[model samples]
Target: MTLDFDQICALLPHAYPFVLIDRAVEVVPGQSITALKNVTGTEPFVQGHFPRRALMPGVLMIEAAAQACCLMMLAGHPSPKPLYALGRVERFRFRSPVRPGDQLVVTAKADKVVSTAAIAEVVCRVGEVEVASGRLSFGQVGSA
Candidate 1:
């Protein structure tokens, strides 16, 4: 299944400037998801991250990965209010810098899933090169 921008906005708790993902091109309900994030030169963070060189923050990549996992997890429970949140990130490595005009392909696959929590492995890439990889744990929040 594919989730468009509006659909993502509804599922992701982050608003406007904080929403890290663009769209989800593939989703396997509670199993996995593949999402896309377009990095642009004019993004607010890139302007202040450096004067001459613009590198997307590694934390944002992890956030994006977490969002991908949340999307996958949420896809299975479409009627509920948003609850899952990134609880932890483990064994994550940033292999290269993310630059403007680059498209990040983030794929997350479930490693474990429970009623209130989940763990997923995430990998982000640009073209054929890997940018980051790790495992993320998520926990239900907000009245779960």
Candidate 2:
């Protein structure tokens, strides 16, 4: 399954460049999804993140991972809810700098899914190299 910006906004609370993810290229219910994020110089963060060489922040890369998880959650249901309280991140490492125009492939796999929460192992990559990897925890809200 794939989602556009309006659909994404309906699922997640983040807006504009903060939304991080642009779309889901692949999705499997309660299993995994791969989402894409297009980092651009036009993004607001670029203005202050660096004066001339704009690099996407490490935290935003993690946000992209979370967005991929959100898409996976949405793909499973007739209706979906926003994920709340990003519990923790473990073993997160930024291997390379993500620059403007880089296409970030964020992939997430559900390690566990329950009534109240879900846990996933997530990663961000560019081509063949791993850019970031970590475990992400999510709490499901009642509604979007």
- How high is the CA lDDT of each candidate model? 0.90, 0.82
| Stretch of 10 with least lDDT, candidate 1 | 73-82
Query: lDDT, candidate 1, residue 56?
Result: 90
Candidate 1 residue-wise lDDT at 122? 94
| Tens digits of per-residue lDDT for model 2, 29-80 | 7789888888888888889899888999898888889877877876657644
Give the TM-score (vs. native) of candidate 2: 0.90
lDDT of 1 by residue, 1-144 (tens): 999989998888778798889999999989999999999998889878876999999999999899888889877584656588788889999999999999999999999999889999999999999999999998998732
For model 2 the local lDDT of residue 144 reads: 66
Q: Estimate each model's TM-score.
A: 0.95, 0.90
